[model samples]
Target: MNVLEFLDSPELTPGTFEGDTWEPWRAVLSGAFGLPMDKGRARLFKRLSGGRKAPTSRVRELLVLAGRRSAKSNTSAAVAVYLATIGAEMDGLLDKLKPGERGVVGLIAVDRAQAKVLFRYIEGIFDASPVLSKLVSKRGAESIDLNNRVSLEVHTNSFKAVRGRTMIAALLDEACFYADENSASPDVELYRAIVPSLATTGGLLIAISSPWARKGLMYQKWKKHYGKNSDVLVVQGGTQDFNPTIDPRVIKEALEDDPEGARSEWLGQFREDISDFMRRDVVEQAARVEPLELPPCADTRYFGFADPAGGGKDEFTMAIGHRDGERVVVDVVRGRRGTPAQIVEEYAALFKDYRVSRITSDRFAGSWPADEFKKHGITCDQSAKPKSQLYVDSLARFNSGQVEIPPEDKLITQFCNLERRTARGGRDSVDHPSGGHDDRANAVAGLLAEAATRPANIIFECLDDGYEPEWHPYQMFS
Candidate 1:
């Protein structure tokens, strides 16, 4: 049976996917599979597909941009199940696999927890259908092997792991939110990795996600293909456009609270205020290949900065740096998860080793960091600038190759993930992405800013009566 017939048949999907709520998704699937559509659905197909005619053959790629609670995950799960079972056999996709090779249907999400949501939906559809349930030959935590040498798998976003697999279809859940420390553009890299695997089987690539910033692969595809004719089908709609059952009051309240976020969440619009703070290549250009941490040099006059945490979800991080001619070189960056007192003590010892008696830090915990550091014979002074301004000041140094940072993964990842947001007052603020931490990045930025802006220190040595005095310009002004 066709995908629409399978979804509508009560004996096939049972109590699941009832009513006209799934009509929008059915139209999407119809356009994707080159199936015939009614006049109304044809209009929707054109509207969503950028006013282009429906394809005469199945599209190789599809991009879905819809609002939250728009049934993207469920619809994707259904499509994956369909492609794995009946569609594979009917379309001769299984014949493309080599001998003893099993075809895969990969459902990849930003993380394991998100992948489970799609996996559970797939499990529910199979459990609800007698015909599809019988096709499940074996089921594992992250995979389900079917009887037809085709398997449905759940995977977290990883470009390396998805390579070399023969896939009939690959669904990217929440493609806009994919982030990786090792990659500058995780979504694009992952797409590149999955495409080669699908080339062997003539498989489908479907990316369904809500709009984020006006960047990333989702935005790029939307900008290029939306409302224009292209081989790749791009569909975008608001919450109600896809699922009308959601209450209007919820979205209304959200709009009242945060208009930009609400529009992105419920109206399917990309946020204009958020953008990347620094590019990965820019950060890499300032990073040294070897020596992740430098030992304290007696000849160097170091400046230290700390970002303190209360031993909770956040980490207490410290960074030490010194000025090298016109450039700032980060000597060391340390992060620890423990009680604030113990962390402060450890940082104080490290500071003393570098002969750094004074350090700058954010206004985190106020007088607590000052008091704690004072106990260990180190002076902690609150920075005159905020974290956002510190990042702003460091941006030029990073872009101009005036800073050298150690190749630390967490530190580099945090720096790469930082977002520069423009406020209504026309002021720009830099910060890490939501649900991400940037203690290491914050400390490094603070120290780098201090090292760059502060005047060079002058030291004079008194020699014999007639000898000329020598001056050293290496220390930072306390």
Candidate 2:
């Protein structure tokens, strides 16, 4: 039976989907599978697809742009189940696999927790149907082995994990929000990896997510294919468009409070104020492949910066750098997760090793960072500029090829994931994306800005005593 027939059978998905609430999604799936639709659903299909005619044959790719609380995850689970069991058999996908090769149906999400939600839904759907339950030969935490050669698996947002797999189908839930510690564009990289796997099986690829910034793979696909008659079918709708059960008052209040955010969360529209801070190519150009960390030089003066955390989820990070001609060379960057006091003491010792007497940091814990560093004989000076300004200044350095960074994975990822947003007041701010950390990036930027802007020191020896005093030319005596 086809997916539409399975959804209509109460015995197959009993009490799982409401017909009225899921009508629009039903129309979407009908168009995706090239099934016939009624006049009403056909109109919705055309409207959502940018006035294009419904596909007469099954499309290889389907991109769904819908708002939050639109039941995207549940619908994705249902589609994955259908594709893994009946869809695979119908397309003879299992027969295409070589001997002893298992065909996989991958369910990918931004993180493991998010992926588990989709997995549980799939499990529940199978358990509700006695006929479908018999197909499960074995069950694991992240995978389900079917009696046929196909298996259902859960994955986080990483391209490496999906490589070398024989895939029958791949579903990317919340594809627009995919971020990784090692990749600037995790969704695009993961998509590139999955496409080849599906080539041998002539499988389906479905990506469903609420709209984000006008960037990344989801936005790009929507821009190129939403209203066109391309092989790839893209559809977009709001929360109420797909699920009318949601309260209108809630959406109204949300829109009143934050129009830009609410539009993306409730109206399925991309935000206009947000954009990427740095391009991947720019960040990669500043990184050196050899010498992950540089030792202190006897003749070079170093600048130190730290981003302190109170032994919580955030990491306490420190970066040491020095001037190399006109370039700001980051010598080393270290991050530790432990008691704040211990981390401060460890960083202080490292600072002294590099002959650094003073370090700069933002006023994170007020006088606490200063007091702690004093105990270790290191002077901690609060930076005059905020973290956002530091990032703004550092961007110029990156763009001008004046900053040299080590090939640190976390540092590169943090730099590439940073976002620059324009506020209502017409001010621009730079920082990491939501649910991301920038401890290392913050420290590096702070030190780079300091080193680049600091004036050169002039030293003079006292005539009477063999003592030398250093001073900046701009210094004035009272």
Candidate 3:
């Protein structure tokens, strides 16, 4: 019989099994292979579920790392349901919770809408299985309530929501997209919050997702912790490892259609989806190594930048630039929730630093930001277009391979986090979803805006016609 049948017996439970309660589940685990699942997966299930004596000491947490359409949703749903019903119907769930206390379990994701998908998967459990359907009411509980009332709840990628809750465990879906200061990567922060909640009860925190954007919390955790911890169960797989659900013919076409997309989704790596997204690598390739500091310029024809926020925190971005023959160098400054007057002052400081002749204000918030700048003796014109359109058009340089970028970590991070989605009219566009921070993207847009209009004149202070510059390389390079 399968796991469902094994869990039905009371004799297999504690005090009767002669061993830890976790041991009895292994026999049930061995039976999953009776189905049409991959033999490799069946073997893995046996290995992981073997003689489960008190779970892992250090690895109370479990992460199922797999590729797109790799049965993650089904696996996650089954696991959650299993915990809810196993051994006293989730009563023991609190016995080994993290932080050694009874606490709520958090199911966090990209946003409210995104979080609903996983919950829906879980709801299907009650519908599909005849045995489980009898035990659970026709309408399942809205939240992940256990048999005894302890439950799992969802919160969109809001750092504030995760901050105070006493979390026994957390199931992080699309963990790379959770909230940050300006991005949605809260690996450091979320772990900090989850640690205390699971301390007493020994809770498990499982972070599962198809890899995208390097350096986020999920990537960092996978890199630093994976093999080092023997207790944690990490199941990583590829599209090649899946069963009959995905057709081989379709996989071949998808791989051939967009090679980059396949690498990230199928291979479980962190990279961009160039197929649907306007390939920013096109711009990344054209970057040059310039000599100056703040903004690397093509040459010295300084122009102004204006990122006009709605004064209520809708958008905050700006870039001032100088061009040198198809080269665009930008120095960016940005802010949020500031009055139009305050923004004008910020731009005045930038104008002097950049020494620009023209300024483009992202006028979505409209006239107030630009008009406020006029009073401060800084003039800028309204750029009356959607930010998405401007971002896509600017990427022409990236697609053509004609931009230069620094090795700064945050800058590169934001660039990588930019995602592509299907837009109206059957076209694709690049954007950062609401869960992730977009400040770096704003800086990029500011840079791109300045690039759109190249200056006609060039000027540089006289240094030397005969003096030879020192030719030196860094110790790391040499």
Compared with the true structure, model 3 gives a TM-score of 0.54
lDDT of each: 0.86, 0.87, 0.54
**RMSD values, in order shown:** 4.2, 3.4, 11.8
Q: How do all the candidates rank in terms of TM-score, highest first?
A: 2, 1, 3
lDDT for model 1, on a 0 to 1 scale? 0.86
What does candidate 2's lDDT look like per residue over 1-478, in tens digits?
8888878778788888756777898889988989999899899889878888899888999999999999999999998998988889887888899999999999998888898898899999999999889999999999999989889999988898789999999999999898876677788899999999899999999999999998999999998898999779999988999888999999999999988889999999999989999988999999998799998765556779988888776789999997766788899999989999999999998988777768898756588999999998888988888999999989989999988999998999999899998877789999887667888999899898779665333222222321112333453221
Q: How far is candidate 2 from the true structure (C-alpha RMSD, Å)?
A: 3.4
TM-score of each: 0.90, 0.93, 0.54
Residue-level error in angstroms, candidate 2, position 386 = 2.2
> What is candidate 1's lDDT per residue for 265-328, written digit by digit as tens?
9998899989999998999888899799889754556779999998786789999988767888
- Which is the winner by TM-score between candidate 2 and candidate 3? 2
Candidate 1 least-lDDT 10 residues: 462-471
Q: Give the distance in Å from residue 13's predicted Cα in candidate 3 to where it truly belongs.
A: 20
lDDT (Cα, 0-100) at 31 in candidate 3: 32
**Residue-level lDDT tens digits of model 3 in 265-370:** 7756566432223443443454445432365343344665566655453456665555545656554445455665775677676665544534677655577766
